[model samples]
Target: MALPEPGADRRTLDADRATAVPTMRSAAPLLKTSTAGALLAIAVMVAATVGAAIWLSIIDQRRQAQEQLTRQAHAAALQIRARLIETEQLLLLEGSGYAASADRFRRDMEELLDANPALLRVELRGRDGQSLVGVDAAAPRPTVAAATRTALSPEAAAAFDSAARMNRLTYSRPYYVTFGATGFDLMELVVPTGAVDGPMIVAVYAPQRILDHFLPSDQ
Candidate 1:
């Protein structure tokens, strides 16, 4: 074979370069498109993962808050129940407070009223319901929660008579009273002082005051 001419070899090399250039240019666009698609897919996956993590955190926080509220409510309920029991014990055990002299009885009843926010009034009365030593809270003093109340409701009379005969503490049926300026839906406690035929201690409560003084805030 004749030796290849230098000019012909140069022409062949140039043709190969032209074809290769176009092929490389076409491949470049495909490579860039594939890279951009991959990047978009990764971004979507990352966003989904972050969203799931945030939602789970919010749920956990809500659950913890609910549990804390339940515990606080239960603790408050137990405290209120204990206070009620202590008041009943005081009524059953402390009768000398009513049996003292008039001045002493007034002072004692004053102290009792001051200490117990739920008590509206307390009175020392004869079996016939004549008021002796009386202490009235006279609250907000728009109306009087009176200690000098001589007339008794039928329910209060029945309870007083029973306590005098039985020589024990007794409770009256819930009743409404408009003795002073305002009205009250209340209950009475008739506590005997010493013997079956002796004098008695009478007390009345404002139920709303009991809830306000005893229950926890936000309840």
Candidate 2:
């Protein structure tokens, strides 16, 4: 009354409304919470990135390990090959120094085969594919293909004849020999020995396991 103090109630109503509607100043805590949430999301993203990096690193390490193992296998194969070549050279040197004729050579070959059962085959072949000396002294010489005899081929007959002509110590780059059948490329070495005037052939065969033994288990 007093005429309702002319707008006093209105002022009171306005004050109540102001109290009901939150002020901008009171929202600082909410802003802080929003900022914390954004920071948490960034942390999650960073953690995922780090995890991916770690996973990639482990994969790279495994790849490197596999490559190293492969290199070792190849190196072992090469070493076995070299030792085989050396063995062939030694056998030829010993044979040429002691054996003068086909008979002496045959005897030497038999003794060699007897002493080392691992020696699959040790033979002396003429360029014409004739067996001059061999482990089975009674085995007949088989005809070699003209294509093989003169050139480098996996066919044993031709390779043997081809190896016979090389003047220096030559290795026939590994071949296989089967009974009553042509040989395949394995790990055989053919060495040419004899006087410098006319070289003789010395073909040596051994188990392919010699190389396989050096290979790693994974290989």
- Maximum-lDDT candidate: 1
- Reference-based TM-score of each model: 0.61, 0.55
How well is each residue in 89-160 modelled by candidate 2, as lDDT tens digits? Answer: 666676465345767666777765554333545566554555555554222332233333343345454455
Give a tens-digit lDDT track for model 1, residues 1-219. 899877998899999999999999999999999999999999999999999999999999888877786776677678766765666566556666557567766776687777777777787888778877678864663234353366877888899888888888888998877764667667778988775456788887766676676555652
What would you estimate as the lDDT of candidate 2? Answer: 0.59
Once model 1 is optimally superposed onto the true structure by TM-score, how far is the C-alpha of residue 12 displaced, in angstroms?
A: 24
Give the RMSD in angstroms, all C-alphas superposed, for model 1. 5.4
| Model 1 spans > 4 angstroms off | 1-74, 138-148, 178-182
Itemize residue pairs with steric clashes in candidate 1: none
Give the poorly placed runs of model 2, Cα more than 4 Å off. Answer: 1-40, 101-119, 132-154, 173-187, 196-211
Positional deviation of 29 in candidate 2, in angstroms? 11
Q: How accurate is candidate 1 locally (lDDT)?
A: 0.75
